[model samples]
Target: MSAHRSLSWLFTLGLLATLPVAFAGGIRGTGDLGLVIERTTGSVRILETSGNRFLARVEGLGDLSHASVVYSRDQRYAYVFGRDGGLTRVDMLEARVDRRVVQAGNSIGGAISQDGSLVAVSNYEPGGVRVFDAATLEPVADLPATFGDGRRSKVVGLVDAPGNRFVFSLWEAGEIRVADLSDRANIVVTRYEGIGVNPYDALVTPDGRYYIAGLFGEPGLAVLDLWHPGEGVRRILSDYGPGDEPLPVYKMPHLEGWAVAGGRAFVPAVGAHELLVVDLESWDPVARIPLQGQPVFAIARPDGRHVWVNFALPDNDRVQVIDTESLAVVSELEPGPGVLHMEFEPRGEEVWLSVRDENRVLVYDTDSLAVLTELEAATPSGIFFTARAHRTGL
Candidate 1:
């Protein structure tokens, strides 16, 4: 071969090597990934959030009626908590289950430890919280929700704190308990009793300083200072209820839907058609925004400028968008019946909502309230994005 030709051939090979290689199917980053829970089918459909693309489906998980998921720090694994107390660890990259165990008779949800080393499940059947090794799904510890009378109370609102601790609420006992898993083998449990009557659900602040439990037996919220345990539990919004004859609560409100946006918290008002906007710094009531029906999930967009809320049974077909700046409902959308869950894209540009009765997941533009696209799902309920991996209180 001629020397000039040889030189040109070598240069061509070098240029080809510098170009990106396309993997089989497609290459997806963590930011482009998400999961939609197929509740009745006991399966999860992986999605490409950027384009509303359905990637794959993983099945065989049991009783996912009220399911919740948390991701690993790297966003590679998903820990799915099922109502039947099934804890399944799914490999996001591989789109398969890595490990699973039926840890209890019934479980409400779960949380992954901050360090990504532990996964905790909040149970209702046997009534307690169980911690498992993140990688192996091996049992680490079990803390039963036992009251002073020795009766087991249902556990709820389990969240992971910064200091290797898991905080949760006891339903029957109406207490908040913080379990220090710093030393996993020797778990240290701290209980704060009499916070309220029938604490249903709880959530930790983004800063990991406050743990707030929503009361079911009363018209108030139980707040605890994780940073200052000695300060004790305080009840806020005690007078937010209408009167002695409160409206019937068809569905229990979820605090996980409570959103912290722009130094304020948007909480769902139980047994009412309103949202209680509270000043996070002062823990004071700021405003009450009336809604279409009983609010289920009042989730805020990542930008903190808007919050999207879904409703309970009779009003479950519609969703309301709340403008944080004005504290008012700016837009209302009826995606379909049985709107179960909504998850915003990491950048707040789009939102993915599961319409269970319609058997579809709809993606919408956050600003225009326009439907971007839709994907079919089976009994879909919760839409979880991989971006939650970096957030403190997932």
Candidate 2:
């Protein structure tokens, strides 16, 4: 054989053999995640955040794919929710498809369960929430966030509570629904409505005795006693020398995400672009963590030294890291656009955020807020960390 032909053939053979074995560890087919690209109408990109470098790209899933995603408690798999309600499971380990299981009721942009067993999805267009099983991906249950008083109730957020109950936020009715998830068919629970017209989110305290409702409408906090369930839920920060005009169902001013630590709860107000620090013992707005943009999610590090907040819009390009003690914006890492949601690894060292508009996932060093690298997706929408989400032979 000629020398030039021999070298070319050898290189081609090596490339063929290396390609299959390189990503062989990542599982594919039924158990992997589906990177849904809504805008491109092409293949969806899969990101391997678990690895050092953001290795990527997958074909065939196409656009109009998954919307929201949920990771199993064991970190065994991830479920992607389509905009039109198509739900599929992605095996994280192998980084491939598992199979389709269920579809949602409407166009939901968010989904998460309290126990990580059942998925609660927010239906944007239809204005409701759908609940489903975490494993089987079947139509286990469905419900709305409406109140008996006849109002357009939209599901904003839903968190799993103890005693097989779910505390849901009603965007329009301005109430909180604690439904009995034990019986999916005929679930029943008491509804608590007070404080404001639209409670953006409801949070159960660690003691499980009382809960905090983010009064987005009026821009304050509401305290509900679990023992009473209703009994006229008390309005906290009612007279902190009020200044602004109070109204029914005012967003942006709404407080979302609950960080309960050091005998207090930290609520993020997206409208004011600040963290409404509330003391559980006193139930008052102690102080405000002035962030750069409208903050949506706030999660504390393991040492409690810092808490990271994701800005939703108007300033969706930054992830502000605040010092827990000073409660000041220590550093801001520019992670591109649409940095709405983020989650930490089990170690609390790695932060994974989805730049939905940019179609990329930015992984940052928790301490320095420095960009380690980024995982690019076709239209990378939702992301999650798998601490224990394992996978076998695909």
Candidate 3:
């Protein structure tokens, strides 16, 4: 071969050698990644989801008592919302914090815009929502939950809806508001007042058509037809509880824990040992399956066949599986003490759960209901996977 030809061949060989490095920066698939939040230590552990291997730990996050995470569309960055209002953008590939900001005094959770350009946080201290640039973590807009003689209310259940909108509920105001971010510089607010008494948490349907808020001070829930906003909000199941006598509430049921399966919704009844099955079509209560204890998180498996539920306080050590088709408890597993949270694999093959008291993360096969692997962690609370990037209203 001529010298020029030989040099060209050498360059081609070098390029092929570096191809693996390029792919390493991007997640190869959902099987290769996930995050475990250590609530007490204010840190996160990146893991290889398939093998249950610990990859890296990113720390120094502040007051993570009630933290949550959302990933960018590319699944390369994780936006973590902390209890102390700390929003830390973490680079999943490099296993480090790319950017960090303390936007408020206290924050509950957050959501990312449809186009992945904005990150919006729901706050409690100053009682407001703040939108920031997803790339830079810079302030984009500040929306305060002010009402009734200018008094602020704690904002909860903040979610990003289509058409550049961020929807949330005000706990004290008993209202729901939609902030249009089409013009991110100045948000146009649409308020739907008198939603219910003490709206604790809310969630948007998978199709982004309906937004429901669970009332803490009442037995029923408030629903809003997002596609038809002119109809306003209406109360559903207004008399769902045992009459007159107040029900005992161990912990406030989180709306985020509510699950949807096969055209129906399995919601944990507030302060009750039952899962209320609601028909998504008519918005009526269909059935209530009695559970072991007050449900904390009742999440549906990806295939919509089974729902795994964990309880609050004294019953947190156990997790039970419910069959969606028959509407009955199918299986039960003891996950040890402080079973804080659970997340299934993207396709529903396996699940990863955080057992805080045991200082371990347990991985179980969904079909067998058997523990496959366990990785040591410290006070782990939430388990998030990059696969959430492709889902709506995550």
Candidate 4:
């Protein structure tokens, strides 16, 4: 098979949401664009591709420093999961906040369903998965963080499983959960033990065939078949790094900065100053992408050609762009300060970088690899982009 087709077919199988959504159909392609999910401003900014300039801003969010943007299957809605446990409903077309529900002390982050019918939130501190209505931005009734057992569970990763079903990770329990979002009124599911200690994130491949979870506490991995969610949830610990010393697991893995795409998972190994690229087929490490400093937040280009990574260390002032194919650091672009999260404008080549310490959003030219514009934010910590999510136009 050809290389690009090999990647595309792998995705035909995988993976949405809410609030009076009039948008239609799945995305054809993001076009020449990048989307920035701004946390501090509580706004998603639109940077036009004509240049790295703010074209328009999606408004009406509040103190969203720890939120994430996961688009609907059709790109009609953008689900904003906040660190403070605020779930905001946003209209992708109108570029406005439709509604929001706040969960106290909850840092909501996880995977959305492919059909955009359900959303799963991993409450790290409290240790549970909160199911929600994808469109109306409301909560769905389900088994409320309960197991017939006495042991309290700690959930870190909640994923969209097959046929609009849901699976969650119990970090403290070292187990995987299969729940029914399709029947949210009275959800029924089972839990199976896996290889790792604190499972941080889980994602289904584009083709909707396989699902994998990354372990944050131990050097372990879990792979499962989507159809038989209960079975095949096996944990593999073969490819663990050298000098693999056991760390304290008082709490679950602390958001080790992870994301998945193009049949690969990019997980930040802060202690090692490297990113683990896990292949889906064998469910193993195909390559280790190294960086100069401690990598924190990471993002992949829409084309799947490159991945942008940031280090939490003070010395790493710039974001390093890596060629995904070669697993090599291609270039480092400047936005300055301790850069953390990133968002791509919907209509441009620019990726918005959140320089928290600098309190600004730097728009860099993707082609020239130069800073084109910088929008000073009010205590800028996170950045996002929201625009008229055009179907035909984009």
Candidate 5:
């Protein structure tokens, strides 16, 4: 070959080596990515919130009618829990399901441990909690919800606590249990019975110090202080039930939706059109603000300046925003029908809401209360952002 041709070939080879590095930089980060669950389609739509655009749709996730998601600490992977017991680990960066396994017959939801090394699922069919290795989706331990009569009770409200412990509630047995998984070889399980009748759902305070369970068979709430587990569980708001002739409940209230702002907790009242405000110091009722219908979710913005609430059935089309300082509803918006869920941006400047009936997700400006963007979706139910990876109970 000529000397000129040899030099040109070497130059082309050098350029090829630099091309891969340049292309890798274009790959987006998972911090700005999120997932929207499509209940009817059994799929999830991966989204890029920075540009407010749809990225990809991952299908074949079984029975997402009651799906919930928890993110890995790196924010690159999302663990999706489907109602059909399908536990899927999704790679947000790749926009695909990385690994999946069906661990039980029916699963309610799950949580990622504080260290993000384990994922635990609460089941209703077999009545037990299953813990899995976060990276490989392999079973690590199984703790059954067996009660007095040698029968397994349905589990609910499974949440991850600070010390790599898992806290959950027993629906049928009216009990709360804590499973300490810090040491795999020596697992410790603690049970607190007679917590409340039909403890429907629960939530751990952002500080991870308190685990509060909302009772369904009655009106009160069950509170447990993780800092002092020896005190057992105590009842709060026992006499706060709506008196005789209470309205029919359209849907159960989500305890995870409880908003803790300004030393108080704002929660939806079941079987009533009201939002109850509780003083966190005393865990007593401070005030009750009337609403449009049976309340479902009462969520607060990141700054805690305002709270956004949605209803069920007849009032499902409306969303009300309450001013935290005054503890009153300042704005009411009719954002179409079937408003299923709401998620605030990491900075609390914008919020995303899933309008299932309209098949769209609406993003609203927190300051102006105006619609900023509306993207098409397929029966979207839950809008989970990767920011949840850093939070304690989310």
Candidate 6:
């Protein structure tokens, strides 16, 4: 071959290699994508935040009245857990359900394993946790939350922990169980008794070091050090409840929205209009910032500069932002009625909220607190983003 001809052939191969990257540059990945659940219709709308537009609307999801979602490691698929025990695997790119199964009578929520190889659901009716293969949606193990003379307890606070393990709380049993699945063939579960009564929900720290369960039957929270599991569970904020007769709780606070900013944890006070701030170093209550109503979700920005909180009924229409450093309500907004949930952008530039009563989803600029966009939906609730796939607990 001629020297010039050989040089031209080499240049052609280099251009071909660059073509794929150039083409991909025009296509946005799933990182900028998210979904909003239409609770009334049992459907979800795939949203792309970069353009503030809806990509597709998928329907026929069962019983999303209290639905929650978790994403695969690649963020290409989402596992939706519904109230009617329906586990639906959704393909975000195709905007369709990849797989669906009714695994139990009733299920609260679910989590993906740390390694993203397994998905686990916590059931309320049958009272157990079921682990499934993430890729195939096939059952890998069945863990019944049985305790005290064959009574099955409802499982709550299901979270993926480090080391390919699952940690959950047993409602009726008043216990916490850590299921180790490091070896698929041999599953080991360590159980802790007396982990606080009626542990409704729980959260794990970002570092995957602590698992805390919020108690409904008591005033305090139950904390377990995953690093020191043999140390068992300890009680925190045991006397944080009200001194006088507490007001009626409109809705149970979601601990999944617990925020840790600047080494402090901001959590909702049960049955009270307050945001309890705790020193993460000591796991002790530092201060309680009074709120407008019972706080439902107290979430922090990614930068830890601020916390945005939504309240329960009668105050549900309002959202208050708290300055993490100042420890005060910085700003407030009334997006609409029935503000079910809030999700921040991956970098915390914007926040998306589901307004059920108005049948809309509102996006707001975090810095300016201005309405960026409004989307139409039936009755949206949980707003989940692909960013959660990288977080420890959602």
- lDDT agreement with native, every candidate: 0.87, 0.59, 0.87, 0.61, 0.89, 0.90
Q: What is candidate 6's local distance difference test score?
A: 0.90
Can you write out model 5's per-residue Cα lDDT over 1-394, one digit (the tens) per residue? 9999999988877754544322234655678879999999999998878877777788889999999999999998999999999999988766667899999999999999999999999999899899999999999999999999899999999999999999999999999999999998898999999998999889888888889898888888899999999999999888878767678877887877337778788878878788888887888799999888888888889998999999999999999999989988999999999999999988899999999999999999989999999999999999999999998888
How many clashing residue pairs are found in candidate 1?
0
Error of 3 at 274 (Å): 1.0
lDDT top scorer: 6
Cα lDDT tens digits for candidate 1, 1-394? 9999999988867654442221224464666788899999999998887668887788988899999999998887889999999999988777777899999999999998888999999999899999999989999898989898789999989998988999999998988999999987688999898888898888888898888888888887888888898899988999888566667788887886339889888999888899998888898999999999999888999889999999997999999999999998999999989998899998889999999988998999998888999888998999899888888778
- Each model's TM-score, in the order given? 0.93, 0.74, 0.92, 0.74, 0.93, 0.93
User: Higher-lDDT candidate among 1 and 6?
Assistant: 6
Instruction: Provide the global lDDT of candidate 5 against the true structure.
Output: 0.89
Q: Which digits, one per residue and each the tens of the lDDT, describe model 2 over residues 201-229?
A: 66566455566777655656767776677
Candidate 6, residues 36-105, lDDT tens digits: the string is: 9999889999888899988788888899999999999999899999999999999887677889989999
Q: Can you write out model 4's per-residue Cα lDDT over 99-121, one digit (the tens) per residue?
A: 78775466657557655676667
**Per-prediction CA RMSD (Å):** 5.3, 6.6, 4.3, 11.6, 4.1, 6.0
Two-way lDDT contest, 1 vs 4, winner: 1
**CA deviation > 4 Å runs, candidate 3:** 1-31, 242-244
Ranked by lDDT from best down, the candidates are 6, 5, 1, 3, 4, 2
Best model number under TM-score: 5
Q: Tell me how far the alpha carbon of residue 324 in candidate 1 is from the true structure, in angstroms, after superposition.
A: 1.0
Error of 2 at 185 (Å): 6.1
Clashing pairs in 5: none
The candidate 4 region of ten consecutive residues with least summed lDDT is 15-24
lDDT of 3 by residue, 1-394 (tens): 9999999988877754544322344435533577899999999998887667887788988889999999999988889999999999988776778899999999999999988999999999899999999999999999999999999999999988888899999999999999999886677999999988999888888888788888888788888888998899988878786346655777877776338888887887887788888888998888989998888888999899999999987899999999999999999999999898999988899999999999999999999988999889999999889887766677
**Local error of candidate 5 at residue 116 (angstroms):** 0.6
The Cα error of candidate 1 at residue 105, in Å, is 0.5
